[model samples]
Target: MANAERRYSKDHEWVRVEGNEAYIGITEFAQDQLGDIVYVELPEVSSSVEKDEVVCAVESVKTAADIISPVSGTVIAINEELADQPEMINEDPYSAWIMQIELSDPTELGELMNAAEYATYCENEE
Candidate 1:
């Protein structure tokens, strides 16, 4: 429950801002939907991106999905560990982050929902 109180996007992406950077990862629901993760394509460090833009890509047993950015910014870090064991996403989606960005819009977080709200939203989604 690392982000049990963190904000989430409608796309099932989660955002947890710590300082000027925001950690990005797919939700458990999204992970479950994708099945076992087999590959991850990440953005290069120092690359720029916009909100709702594809920052990375991930492929699973069932499908592949673009890792859309919740906020516009420059990528500062990516988890290279996933290259060897992408299945870590299935093991712990929250911890298996795809990337981190120095945000362009801090207000974007204000527009997202906290974990409790996201959980309720996810419930209604089904």
Candidate 2:
């Protein structure tokens, strides 16, 4: 189930916005598809990313996948714990945020889907 407070992208990335900052991570569906996560390549803290850009990469036992940015912003922080425990994402993708960015354009959020819309989108894909 998608979190009501967060927005989702067609690429299966989720963004939880808090004021000017947005916490970014892959959706539960994404992690499930990837299988057991083995490693995560976290983006640099000060890096700038445009919407749809690859923020980082996640490697699972089955395959490796890029994590796209759902919003344009300067990455301000990352969940360093992922370095040692990448399985945290598979366990709880919502709480295991890969990065937090200072949103460069808040309006870009409008381009993303709400929880319900994303749920429908995922259904269509499946």
Candidate 3:
């Protein structure tokens, strides 16, 4: 089940807003499809990103995928722990967020899908 508090993208990324910042990561469905995660290439802190832009890369045993940013923002922080424990994403995609961004346009969040909608979207994709 997708977390109710977060919004999801058709590209399979999830974003949870807290104050003015949004934490981003791949959805659980995405990780399951990707197989075992082997490495994660995160964006540098303070980098600016536009909505739908490729913000990072996730490499799994099966294949590699680009993680798209769901909203425009300036990257405030990245999960440095992922550098040593990439598998943590497979362990828990929701808790193992890849990056945090200070939202440049909070209204952009309105375009994202809610948990239930995302669940339906994933069902259709499968």
Candidate 4:
């Protein structure tokens, strides 16, 4: 299930917005599907990215995957912890946000799915 307060992308990334910044991470479903995470490559702070761009990459024992940005923005911060403890995402994907983005246009969030919609989308994907 997706968190009620967060928005979701079709690719299974989640975004939790706070003011002008939005925290990005893979959903629980993503981590589960990827198996045990071994590494996470995140964009540097101050790097600009567009909506749906590949801003990060996560690798697991099963496979590696790209994390698409849900909105256009400049990266404000990244979870440096993931460099050493990528498994933290498997334990708690929502809480272990990979990056923080300063949204170029906050309205981009309106295009994302809500919790209920995302849940249904996941169901359909399965």
Superposed model 4: Cα runs more than 4 Å off: none
* Every candidate's lDDT: 0.87, 0.92, 0.95, 0.92
Q: What is the alpha-carbon RMSD of candidate 3 to the true structure?
A: 0.7
Per residue, candidate 1 scores C-alpha lDDT tens digits across 93-126 of 9888888999988988888888888888888988
| 1 against 2, candidate with superior lDDT | 2
Which predicted model would earn the best lDDT? 3
lDDT of candidate 3 over 1-126, digit per residue (tens): 597899999999999999999999999999999989999999999999999899889999878899989999899999999999999999999999999999999999999999999999999999
For model 2, what is the alpha-carbon lDDT of residue 27?
95
How many times do residue backbones clash in model 3? 0
Q: For residues 12-124, could you state the per-residue lDDT of candidate 2 as single tens digits? A: 99999999999989998999889999999999989999988886899998888998888888999999999999999999999999999999999999999999999999889
Name the lDDT of candidate 3. 0.95
Could you estimate the TM-score for every candidate? 0.93, 0.97, 0.98, 0.97
What are the root-mean-square deviations of the candidates from the true structure over C-alphas?
1.3, 0.7, 0.7, 0.8
lDDT of 4 at 95: 94
Give stretches of model 2 more than 4 Å off: none
Q: State the lDDT at 120 in candidate 3.
A: 93
Candidate 2 TM-score, C-alpha based: 0.97
RMSD of 1: 1.3
